[model samples]
Target: MVDVYLFSGFLGSGKTSLLLNVISQIKESGRKPAVFMNEFGSLSIDSDAVENGVPLKEVLDGCICCTGSEQTEAQIQSLLEENKDIDVILIETTGAAHPVEALDAIYSPIFADQLNIRGIITVVDSKLWLDRSRLSPQIRALYMEQIRHAHLLLANKSDLLTESEMATVSMELANYNEAAPVVQTIGAKIAFSYIEKVLHSTKEKSDTSIISGKGLPLSSKLITFTESVSRDDFEEWVKSLPETVYRMKGYVPLEGSINPHLFQYAYGMVSWLPEYVKMTPRLVIIGEGIDSIKYE
Candidate 1:
């Protein structure tokens, strides 16, 4: 049976970083891995980050838990049919997705017999969580739902917070999720070996006691740039963004640069990495009440 692991977290919680690391570790251990990535936008930006040659299936324009369950099951069936030797399948849910509904989607009877659900591993941004009170009540509740159902919790971005802050975050997370173990991490980094031990040894299945009746109202907008823009101008635009903009990521064509730069923004933090090859210059902005934000 193929072991399936579900990754749950809110927007910009470093799910992609953790997925990349897990993929590398699985490869090093001589096991074949497959991926099922879901995106809230029409275009899939994070799927580009997955290493080449890994069997990948993407569910786009919707969250898998709410409106994409049938689509997800079909994709997973195709993935298994195409790759008969896959030892494990890693599913990375959209940041706004709920864990219980995602697990429900995965329990399709058609392929349920062929797979063993390892567990749901959730990544929590320690900083955003600390400031969650500023978010709308709906979003805050969704965040708690994700954490409450995890089989393992990663207190990601631990380096950004002081020792006292981390201690507080760890204590709160442990108290809220006593069923799961909380691990403080930098960039969502944790020993994959340890993850295997915790998940593989767990005999309990996913808890569906509190499933979300509906998906969150989060939305995404895809912005395409026809030409390179000045780095200073882009930075200025980012600075002018409203706090409602939760996450933004894509390849940006920068003036005077030979290749497009990979740009990421999350919770007021921005980063740019130089890319060797030119990618389509586009950005996917996810948030609430952001339809009026102009990119020009």
Candidate 2:
């Protein structure tokens, strides 16, 4: 039977970073890892970050807990059928997705016998969590629900917080989720061995109260650049983004660079990494009412 681990986290919480860490560790340990990634946008960006040759499947433009659930199952089924040697399947859910409903979708009887449901591993952005009150009620509730249902909680981005802030966030998360072990991490880094041990030892079942109906009023817009843009201009554009914008990521062609840079923005933080190959210059902006934001 293949072991499956679900990655649950709010938008910009570093789920993809943690997924990369786990994949590397699994590969080093001589275990084959496959990825099932869900993106809320029309284009699949993070899937590009997965190492080449690893079996990957994507559910784009929908949440796996809702509209994409059927496709998720089918993709997982296809992944398993195509890769018999895979020891583990790392499912990185859309950041906005609810863990409980996602679990409900994966616990289908169709693959029940073929897979082992390891548990939900949640990555919480410590800073945004501290500022969660600023978010809309529904988004805040969804964020909390993600943490409440985690089997293993990762307090990611702890480096950005002060000692006192980390202490407060850790305490609150502990109170919210007493069943799972909360580990503070930088860049979502954690030893895969520790993750395996904690998961194997945990016996507590997830909360069964799955939130039904439509999710938040979140949406994603795909923007493609026909030509390279100056770094200063791009940064200016990013600064102009409204507070409603939650996350933005994609490959961007920058002036003077031979290849497109991997750009990521979350909760007002921006990062740019150089890429070796030229990729389609596209960006996916995810937020509430983002369709009005135009890029000329």
State TM-scores per candidate.
0.69, 0.69
- Tens digit of lDDT per residue, candidate 2, span 1-296? 68888899998999999999999999999999999999999998999999998999999999998899889889988999999999999999998898756765565444545666666789999999899999999999999989976778999999999999999999999988777789999999999999888776643222221111112233344566788999999999999989977667678889999988988776899999998977767776655445456676
What is the model-wide C-alpha lDDT for candidate 2?
A: 0.80
* Backbone clash tally (model 2): 0
Q: Which residue pairs collide, candidate 2?
A: none
Candidate 2 weakest ten by summed lDDT: 206-215
Q: What is the C-alpha lDDT of each candidate?
A: 0.81, 0.80
TM-score of 1: 0.69
Q: Give the 10-residue window scoring lowest on summed lDDT in candidate 1.
A: 207-216
Model 1 off-target regions past 4 Å? 204-296
Q: In model 1, what is the error at residue 165, expressed in angstroms?
A: 0.1
